[model samples]
Target chain A: MPFTGKVLVCEEKVHLRRLLSLIVKSLGQHVLFEAADGEETLLLYQSVKPDLVLLDVNMRQRDGIQTIQALKQIDPDCLVVILTSLVNHLTAEECLRLGAADCLRKDLPREEIAVQLARIIDACFGDIPA
Target chain B: MNVSDQPSPMDLKGRKILVVDDDRLNTRIIRGILRPQGYEVADADSGEAALAAYPQFLPDLVLLDVVLPGLNGFETCRRFKSLYGDACAPIIFITARSESEDVVEGLAAGGVDYLPKPFRAKEALARIRTHLQNRLLLEQLSKANAAKNRLLGMAAHDLRNPLASIRGLTEFLRDGTVGPLSTDQLDLVNNIHDASQSMLELVNELLDVSVIEAGELKINRAPVSLTALIEKAVYLNNINATQKHTRIVLQTCDLPQPYLVDAQKIKQVLDNLLSNAVKFSPSGSTITVRMEAGANGCSVSVRDQGPGIPKDEQHKLFKDFGRTSVRPTGGEKSTGLGLAICRKIMEAHRGTISAANHPDGGCEFQITLPS
Candidate 1:
């Protein structure tokens, strides 16, 4: 299997961030970055420039919508996937309109999340790394 | 006016009542009839005075007489409705005439009820008590409904995050990502993962039910192949069937290729039927899924080689939290919400689901969708 690119897991909860990091690391040989809030996510996006950002929709400051907007400004091609506990179609549609790759429910199985992230990564980066 | 008995303290306590009558003697009689029952009474000799006192009095009910010095009862009731809308208190018109036209006109003008004059204290009190009780019940129901929605929202938001974390961490540990684990530890981790998965399923079902009840579930309809959908549902449930040593076989006869439907919702219906079949069938039993196209539409049925549903319990099959005498053969967890959700989905798709006892002796669940 070829090396997948870097991923940034942005969530307010420490345990969730750790779990996501572990899942991404287990996916393949991939670099991982962590951010506890949208502010941290924006700051880290500049230095890390990860291929994908898993952003939590209900963060303390600068929630998922704001973070996605700022990330798009920084890099038009940046792939941001929303992580939310509530499965709301309206919120997902709004996130997609704001340039999010997808909005995923947090309650989904880890394997399913991994599969979705892999698909998004493949679509964004293709087989050959950029 | 002879007051036979004092009104029940329970019936009239804490109620504010406004009595509008041009006759001061009538107002005095009403106060004598109500004040002893722990009621707060306000007297207005004319419709004009009633209107002036209503805002300040904030009464729970009003007794308005039609023959007032100014602004008669019907017109006063209409103005009261305009002022307070549905929030206006219940008004019982006190009139001298019992003519149907007068009653109809009073009702049309926003009076909830009418009392014929030469007022019998007992009848008047009885009507007042009934209306107040009904209004109280309606208020309580509305409040309870609002609270239920709030609780549902909070549960959908707060419960899933922890459940996701637990499932993820358990899977992480089970996969031996951090280090090797003993067989015992691995089994424990697997159990935790399964429990979390079941909880997640329950939460999702509850969320779906709430959304459907709120009429917020949106279905994106398209032409979807019924063959492909059944194959996918069977594939998804293969592991579940295998665990219970059950085999699922799909049989189709003159089935339509594709139907205009919401693919995701139909898939959910299929998944629910397949899961129920697998959950109830004995080990080594065969479950056959048959699809047939008819003049009206197409139907898919899953027949399980287990106990047939009780004839008496058939009507309860599609209701929320409906359970039957048959138990899950594989000790699988069921929230008793799967069939309810399936029924709701089918209703949304303009389809139908039914259950019956097959002649060969088992329960068969069927779903029919328009072609």
Candidate 2:
């Protein structure tokens, strides 16, 4: 399966978002949109309608897990991957149970990030860019 | 460690009693003895019936016949003790045999007291009353200890959140990342921020030691980039370094990749050590920091060209509030807890810390934290 569409990368910290966005772009995925928090994330998701979303679990107002719940209520086919620095088991389990595609801790190298994002994008779109 | 207002010991009302005996007349005799003292009484003819009565009657005390056939009173009492350690209400053994060995065996089987068949009813009642009193006191003491620990734990957790917030705000101020300030005011603010951070560090150390003493020191761990940690510590201490015209050089060896650890705690340890190095080293001298990888783990060393730690004082360096004669080179204030805190963090990480004079000159503080 190959994905040719875009991904919505939602994070709060400027440094983390910059580093992660570089990794996402290097993986050949288009950044359809970016949001600093969950409210912005929801509005962006509705407007962009990207193929996938990379979410930071700890965000202001509504968190990624709550945003995932809210998004699923609108679009059940949403593919959300939790992007977080802290990899707590409780959060990981909750994300998986709530229909997240997978969890990727922030410590991963750029290459691993690319590979993981590629897999997730392919899983969503059933194809990838050549 | 001391609770100013401790509660009084609890009191229990006199409840019912169950006396088990194979003989009907013997049971009657025991019932006659207890009935006069406000104790409602019941009887069971065998060990099986006595155990069955325990669940139904839920008696506050039990008198058992030691000679009952098939699951004797000794076995029944042992089972009762297992089900309830000191809180089995009160168990007294009554049997015809008065041999010293028989009495010893009866008490060993969880009988609070062994009474001869013709036991004095008044003495038996008094013994039962005393045992109940003791058990209530013990239960109260255990509850108090548990509550004290919980209160301390909550206070520490609550204190930490604000301390963290304060540290974050101070760091933002020191870095001038939040707003603008004049050169002199910036320096003043930096000093104030550093002092606040030192205070926060001491509070955190106190909380950590309390947690350790309470046997609640568990690491919340993650994979940590050693390079990143060193850089962050150096960045945090840059203000002091620039003030003294001193520099901390982080030299990287051909070490293995990053290791797993509690990054925040380990960062605190590194900051403590580096702060000490900067404080002790003379102005314009360089503080050398190097990392090395080993078969089991990794080690980080911070060396400063200052008067070395005296051999005699080294032994007491890690004791709480213990200070060495060596003062800070830049007139910096120390809480006298930095080394002790470093040792505590290393021990929690299942690692070790040591200080000694480097062959090149001055003293070197080394910490080997496990992966």
Candidate 3:
């Protein structure tokens, strides 16, 4: 059974958003939704109800902290993985404590990042029946 | 003495001066003298009154009389200094006691300067202006320095994201994440990866320095084996040393008991020292990491067999941006901030880091932590 789950990519930068969406797609047959800011991210998430979210910590209008709180409030069990270049220990810990599934640095080696994402996706969508 | 020395200070408004004199006449005289210079004067009849008004008025400079009804000027000055320490406003004792000991006593009590009784109008104004000017200048400098640190932190943070992008994307291209790359393309990708990686390291170092400068360097201590940390550092540095045909010989003389320390931070310090040894050493040379453990304290020293730092430049080793004339043999980039960061980390751990030339060969950097 192939898991074609919805994954929302929330990032402000266009190039990074594209790269992240592609990374999510590389995992499996996943429906990708891209949002440039937190507002759009919430709108898309509400309308689409993604199985997982790849959120950037820093954004223009609404940042990751506020957005993550709102997301968790919307769906307590929703998996929100923080993909950020804000590569600080404190921020990562804060995001994870705020119920982010994982806070991965964007600068991590591609293979390492791929493995982490694959594990997260498999956990969420792998057991789905055909 | 020229009662009318002609260095008139320019008028600046909202500059508050606190006048603490038992005599109402003297307070009025100081007020009359400084009002023309655009100083807002507040009067306190006694040392007790001055202390009471200090919090509200927050005067830039204080003119305190030695004689008071209670809590004499010296006592008040001492209390202010002890209470506020370095942040206490500059105090100048203006009193009838013109004896030389009186001047010394006033200064010893933390008064920045002293003005005699029946002070010359011009001289009194000049002294007040000087102290007030110094206080304002110091405040400006401190604020400017803090702002600079903030700007450095922000700029470094902003650079990190794009740098990460460049580094990650380059590696992905080289690793064939999307598609396989040709030989020439792979070479270019490697170049880009290396460039961005070094740049990222520099940016991170800058961030560390700024954070430390802003007094945000935190040490989280946990039980960590000193010997194990040293071994791990040696192993990590060896990976790069092997590429240059250099060897790191770790001589852990004795195993120390596991102690509470920020293990990650200690590891970083060790990594910096060992890598520096590897970076500066010639190919086919041996870099020795000798750890000496004992009851009172333990020290780990990284000694490299390359050209030692010059006597003149050695003193500059632990300062930020302290780049000596000594060049790396393996063409590895030196951030020059590594030692500075290492020093701060050591200090936070209540340890000390020092660099000195070995008798037999190259420079040795050692860090010692008290047990």
Candidate 4:
């Protein structure tokens, strides 16, 4: 079956946010919230409690690391996956340590993105019906 | 002054020299020898006087006597070094003793050269000239390297944002998110997307080269299946190969599984070789990949049926920006850094990458990794 849960996309770029929103919708998921920075992401996370959060590492005011920390504080078991163009090993490791589910590159192909998202969805819920 | 004995015009123009000796006769001899060569010579009778004169004299070079009344030459040299740090001028010690132990002690004390007390003027001048020239060359080299790194950083930082935007917008249009498009429009948009993606890859490759040159490229080694890595690389390059009607054939062999290596970096090496094979092979040609296990290690070769590299130009294949006479059969754009990056990765892994012309009629690029 299709995913019936909410997702929050926290990216600073408008075009990237729209593209990600489209990809999530195409994968049969609902994007309930969108955030441009860490402060907005934390505020949205408090109210929406999205099943998944796709966060970018580079953001204005606050960054993905701080935001992930705040999100984890709100809910210890929150699922946040980093989506960024910066291919830094240290940042990826730190994000994982801060309770991120995974760190995915923004330059990944659409098919790969869909497959990764589907895998994440499967882990959250049971296997989708054939 | 005899014409033959006169120093050359460029020998000592605007050069400053400081001579330190407890004997006034020795100091006078040094001044008399260097002053005619157009050098501004300053003399001191003791090590303490030399240290005091160092600040105001600011000589380009120092001639120090080993036997001083106070703060012997070795101690004076050490003190000057600590005070000047990197800017410390080259110091030549003047000693009456020519024993090996004395020379060693002088060198250990930070003196770059040792001049016997009865030193000839020509020899002293020659040593000074050589050291000054070497220092100048070193400074120039370091400055050039810093400037190059700065330029690379700015390019990587500035070019990535616009390129990503272009790629994102092109993908949006091509995916029909904006609207439906004609077949030709779709193809054009696809080409635009490919071009932008290639530009992004070039920028990333340049950044990798800079990182490698700066000795910061790190590899996380683990057990990885070679077969799986090769297959993944072939799959990644399948689209480009198909565009040119070229087929990549992977020849499997019974090799050990889960070799210790950096999976991501090895995959990069494979991807670069396969892509190069595809770019240089003619349409409807076959590219072969073969792997074998030997005593030294495992070797993987990618052979292409294209115009082989010329003998004279083969040495330059793995060098940075090394472009051979053989051009890409398909009008593909290359960063000219792919092979160089591959070489660096292989070296980091204690492996080797080499290219040779196949006897039958093509070029073969091989990578050998320690098992």
Q: Which candidate is the best by TM-score?
A: 3
- Residue lDDT tens for model 4, B62-149: 9998888879999999999889987887899997855667788889989899888687889987887777665555566777887786
Chain B alone: TM-score in each candidate? 0.65, 0.51, 0.86, 0.68
- Model 3, B1-371: lDDT tens per residue? 25584234544577999999988887788888989888898999988889889999999988988888879899999999998899899999876754778788889999999888897999988888788888887787789889988998998998877777777677667768779999998998999989989999999999999999999998989999888888888998899999999999988786668878899899999999988888889989999989887787889998999999999998789998999998898777898999999999999999999988989989899899999
Model 2 chain B poorest ten-residue lDDT run: B161-170
lDDT of 1 by residue, B127-218 (tens): 98888876776666667766775677568667777888898998889878899999999999999988888888787777777677667677
Using alpha carbons, what is the TM-score of model 2? 0.48
Candidates in order, TM-scores: namely 0.72, 0.48, 0.84, 0.72
| Cα misplacement distance, residue B215 of candidate 2 (Å) | 10
Which scores higher on TM-score, 1 or 2? 1
- Which sections of candidate 4 miss by over 4 Å? A73-77, A87-89, A126-130, B1-118, B121-126, B231-257, B284-286, B358-360
Candidate 4: DockQ? 0.20
Candidate 2: docking tier: incorrect
Candidate 4, B230: how far from true, in Å?
3.6
Write model 3 residue lDDT over A17-125, tens digit each, in one string: 7666666766778888999999998899999999889998877788888899999899899889988664456676788999998876675555666787888777766
Candidate 2: regions farther than 4 A off: A1-67, A75-92, A100-130, B1-10, B14-18, B28-44, B48-62, B82-90, B95-97, B156-159, B175-371
Over A81-130, each residue of candidate 1 has an lDDT whose tens digit, in order, gives 88866555566677889989877666567888778766766666666746
Q: Please report, as a residue range, the 10-residue window in candidate 1 chain B with the lowest summed lDDT.
A: B1-10
> Model 2, residue A57: displacement in angstroms?
8.0
Say which candidate scores most in DockQ. 1
How much lDDT does each candidate structure score?
A: 0.84, 0.76, 0.85, 0.84
